[model samples]
Target: MPIYEAIYRSNDHEELITVNSIEQHEKFVDVKNHLYCTYQGCTARLSYVPKGKVRAHFKTWPKNNHIQDCTDYFERMVTANKQKSIATSTMALSDKHIKSVLDNLKRKRKEQESGTDKVKTNRKKKPRPKVNPDSFENTTLNIVPTTGPEADLTSGENNIKEPSVRNRSLINLSDDDLNWTRSVECYIQNVETDDNRAVLELRDGNYTFRVFFEEFFFDNAPINFRGYFEDLKYLVQRHKEYLFSGVGLIEKRNEQYCMLVNRGNDFRIDDQYIAIFLQNASA
Candidate 1:
């Protein structure tokens, strides 16, 4: 949780103060002695610090020394995801699932562009397979893909249905939430590319997030996606309003949350397969 307010306790009185309230005064207010964490059940101390470039904000005295449930608490994203993966039987995004989702989106897009509904096929439907509630693969294999306009692209404030595979927004992500693999959504604000790697600066509201694709990732990727960085730049030039949703672990690097695209199947653009869409556009 983004803590805007903190509790101040002195002798027998306890009061609430905000970072903005402290900034309004000409001189810095020294509340380090009395400032307590605003999170309930969290007694960790806080200190106000002014940065040379960014706005002043409260920080835990010992750094991430907050209650377990608090967002600031430190935890390894990889380790947490591994544990959750076992419990949920959730594995990395499979090529079959990715292709199914993208194909579904492409069909919808074509229908929209043509301004026509789907033509009924004369072929008989196959027998439906029974799904196991505890089996992630069995459940997701039948997922009805959501399209660009149909997908819920809003910030993660609403109590959206928490599917077995969670979709998270960087703005509302917490320490506990990052424990599992998440389908994180953010818009690409900028892209930095070099021969070795490419980093996409993403944003959701006022918060900034990043997606990193390294040389190894590109080298191992399929033929169509080897030049993925260039395609991302092309999309930016077109001024297309699109959302980048990558399924990965959210890791904090240099105080910024970043998603490392470890595999090709884990990435998507506006609910469509990244490689397929980029290839079609290039053609």
Candidate 2:
């Protein structure tokens, strides 16, 4: 039996709602009447397996006759075929069949190369804009302090205040704010580290911003402060909840906002910070 943990209810719907959306044993009570397999021409009723019973998931009804030849059924058939192929190493082949296979490989290689060449020829490089150093010489960087319930003392540090301003979504930032320092609290969705830099993809609701960290900052940071970066990386990789604070330089690339953080900026991470920055933005 092929077990599916998620399924679409309608053709027009884009998101997958899991059986875990409902409480344990409440799945049937809540959505049994509404559930349906998304596959066309299949009228299989999805059975919800609640939590604590071999993990919560959705499975096809045992007596679903329509699902015998559906997409999931075909996938299982393909998987079984692959397993059979792997198990049998020796297969008889005629000389003509071998020649046809070699010709197909050559044709595929030529098509791939031609496609790569076309992509290279059509790609255009955008020039980098020159920056004027004088424009930032006398700029006064304003630090806005966060207030209300979400502005409480964060974990791992004492006396540092969280920002209170609510309009910190990436979509709300503009090109005019470039080089200006602003505080944004975002959830770390992704983290990537390389030899020279570390990048963090952060999200506050539908808005997303990238945080850039240069290798110099980590290498030159004091020993006490250096551990914060490692801790942050671990938390983000584990998908743990935390609020990130830093003085960000907003840059617009392809109409999307990205923040650049360099050495000496106030970058802080606190898992105990319970204030929802997204809720404030919406309010």
Candidate 3:
């Protein structure tokens, strides 16, 4: 039998009514008369199945032809129900744990507040440097300064240029060098991913660029890159306003600049740098 937790009623202004919306079976029975399958062209009578060991829910009439052909059929509904059950269970567990921890912290805070009538003489506040918005305006990032054999290897055929006053920031990188590697500091504004590619949109003050990583293949099958992408996604989502540092290949498309970071490149969450940057930005 096909069952659901929700049904659509067109006569009462086309609203979806879930099992949670009604308190009694009699009310559900009343609404059931006006209810219809939300799927288009599906004429199956949605029944309020309140009996048996399974959870009470809405189900389609048995042996209905439209129910068999509908997109919101039995199998899909069961899958969605299972997913919802799991999510609900996980959230309940998380809520219990969080409540316990929060209660403990509140108790501790109250105790501390009650006992802290004495002022600590050694406490001090550090003065912050004022940031000028004009300093970031029209500013450019010079090539990271390098020394010794590292400098020589990066120079010459490696296409690495020395730190100069003339060089532009990563957002202004040109298409002249496709393989050139450069270090950049930027806040990741957004991260998006699909089956084959991950794109990161980064911003530094008023400048912005995108970083793309296409899926690589091995043994004729596409490798799962979700783990790597998830790690980046977690960091960006947790610290949406913080800055990150990475070495990336410069690319240009449609007269716009972009950077590409692959397995060989270095990417790091720059906590200290972000703190300074945020301080400066607010100053």
Candidate 4:
């Protein structure tokens, strides 16, 4: 459950009452029967102070009751999904944006790291960072221009274009080899997206998964990335159906949207998935 604190209306927004901006929610046993606030239209909290005066409090708002009704329903939906997602992180981008970004990234990165198109040129090595590639932030792509011939050699002009190049591993998935995959197997906490517009439904629960969109998309990926993206897109399209077959992704949502929100986990949005989905005009 998310930690809760007193929030007061401020410029038509729910601003947490804080001592030092480190919001410390007052501890209270969550009473299931009480009606919760509708997040659909209103982000404001209405009092149900007496422990069970929900119907009376709910009556205060006449125009948007469906928002209230959907509150617990959405919460339950999220909770139920969490039990299966084991989300290491969660994000909500539109369905189409997610697929486009992932398909582009996965395809490009696969080809780059796989090196199947590589000509094996004797390019001088550049000073490499010890950090894992997954840790490379959004701007790392911009830095490649200064990193010497390895970056140059990795560029698309270096492609060998062989039919055999289709068979190679992209992304180098070093984390999978370095025990991060083991960590990834478990749920992480609530994630914030890079944008402030959406929310992640189910967070870390039964299964946790993450993929960086920028890293996944690449302009230069050829055979491997192209093949991987196609395979992944197909896999996503039938993810729900494949789960019962014992052979595919466990995620749910429109094929594109799933990819969008799935990548949302990696986005640096207001620091959590819930906020991304719930809040607009976030910082």
Say which candidate scores most in TM-score: 1
Best first by lDDT, ranked = 1, 3, 2, 4
Q: What is the C-alpha RMSD of each candidate to the true structure, in Å?
A: 15.7, 26.4, 26.0, 23.9
> TM-score: which is higher, 1 or 3?
1
CA lDDT, candidate 2, residue 19 = 56
Deviation from native of the Cα of residue 67 in model 2, angstroms: 66
- Candidate 3 lDDT tens digits, 13-55: 6666765554343344357666667677777667654422244
TM-score, one value per model: 0.46, 0.34, 0.32, 0.18
Which regions of candidate 1 deviate over 4 angstroms?
1-93, 96-163, 177-179, 279-283
* lDDT (tens digit, per residue) of candidate 2 on 1-283: 4344445454564334565553332233335434657667776677654432144556766555445667665322222222221211111222233234334434444666688422222235453444453433333222332211132233212333222222244434555466444445566887777656677788865567888766555566454334445555665677656656555456666666776655433454541211233233226
lDDT of 2: 0.48
Cand. 4 Cα-lDDT? 0.27
113, model 4: CA deviation in Å?
Answer: 32
Q: Stretches of candidate 3 above 4 Å error?
A: 1-168, 175-179, 216-225, 271-283
In angstroms, the error of model 2 at 249 is 1.6
- Worst 10-residue lDDT window for candidate 2 reads 83-92
Q: TM-score for candidate 3, please give it.
A: 0.32
